[model samples]
Target: MKTANNRLDIAIKKLYTAFHDDCLHPECCKQCAVGNILDHSDAWKHFSDDHGSTKLNYIGHVNETFGKRFNGYTPSELLLIEVTFLKACGYQLPLHFKNNKPENPTNKDNLFKGLQAVIELLCELDKSPNVMDYTKLFDNLRISKKSLVLK
Candidate 1:
């Protein structure tokens, strides 16, 4: 059994690879956020009918009822993560053609935003610090302490 931390690490790494390879896509189940977390499996698509929808379907409810977890995330949690990714990527929920979407879905900036949001959620789910967060590296307190030591 994989620990939550281990699952989160695997998810982050997979997402990083997807983003780097420009394989992340809102329309492709195997390239979506949850899909990447599940090792590029499109099985997660059965969780919801719509691409970005959070409302679970029959399969999702059954899985959730059985306490099934895919890659350490429950069915509902997977939907939340996917919604977060799509939203951050500038897609309106449910992924309709009429809904708003990024002018260029594959743009690095858009994908980076999506990845960041997904990573944050993954960290939150595991109660771990977000590895993608580098802001702490520039903390003034740490910098001041370093300067004092240097002095």
Candidate 2:
């Protein structure tokens, strides 16, 4: 079996490699949200500009557009909001899965290069996916009143 460290290394390496083409090239990036943020900030800014769209409008629009296709409020829509806003602010998040509907704190591991990344992820959470999946990260993670409130 692989050690935790080995698994982490492979995961990170995979993250970088999976996005290599989209990271450097646009045509391959296609409608990729994080790629757009990384390689095409200006265009992403158009979507996320001006403190950008709020969770209400942004999510509602997605619900109408892609949500209709997926059945409703999926990771795709949430990821779009997450990636677009983060990119507008200049942090390219990982687009790991094709249909990933990111809940909150989806990948705290994505430490982004630094503080800016953290803040962007925080802000995006305020605007999208209302669940805090990283409750598992806290040393105090447990089923309590707070956890229930958060849930």
Candidate 3:
């Protein structure tokens, strides 16, 4: 059995990948497998703002100044890449909203609750090393000088 914290942590981990994975590697790099893995180069060409900053983008930039990486990849292709990468990294993504009912019939309260829980958990994780792969992730993606506010 899992506690609220455990459940929330698990949910946040998935949300972390959902929100990031794309921006960590921009499309400006060399194209091919490496390029594709880094960022969907095609997506950036089609989506980046006037300046290189990836703000006004989609597919969940969250904290990363990012937009969606279109890169001429079909939705299915993107899905395959993300899924494969996650699997290779030993992550199994969340199911797309399984059979859970909301206490209120029409308000979408349950879904919103889950989203809120996930966002809160992710925010906590951004600061604390509470996530599962914190060491590996922090090492690979160096923290920015301004971003790390050590107490």
Say which candidate scores most in TM-score: 1
Better of 1 and 2 by TM-score: 1
Q: What is the lDDT of residue 73 in candidate 1?
A: 91
Which lDDT values do the candidates have, in the order given? 0.87, 0.36, 0.34
- Sort the predicted structures by TM-score, highest score first: 1, 2, 3
- Per-prediction TM-score: 0.89, 0.24, 0.21
lDDT of 2 by residue, 1-151 (tens): 1223432233224334434532322113322333333333333323332322333346445555654422122434434544443443334344233433334322333323222332334335345321233545575655565778986
Better of 1 and 2 by lDDT: 1
C-alpha lDDT of candidate 1 relative to the true structure:
0.87
What is the overall TM-score of model 2 with all chains considered together? Answer: 0.24
lDDT at 50, model 3: 25
Q: Per-residue lDDT tens digits of candidate 1, residues 27-72?
A: 7888989888888898888988887888999999999999999988
lDDT of 1 at 83: 95
Give per-residue CA lDDT, model 3, range 25-44, as digits (tens).
21123231213433434443
The TM-score measured for candidate 1 stands at 0.89
- TM accuracy, model 3: 0.21
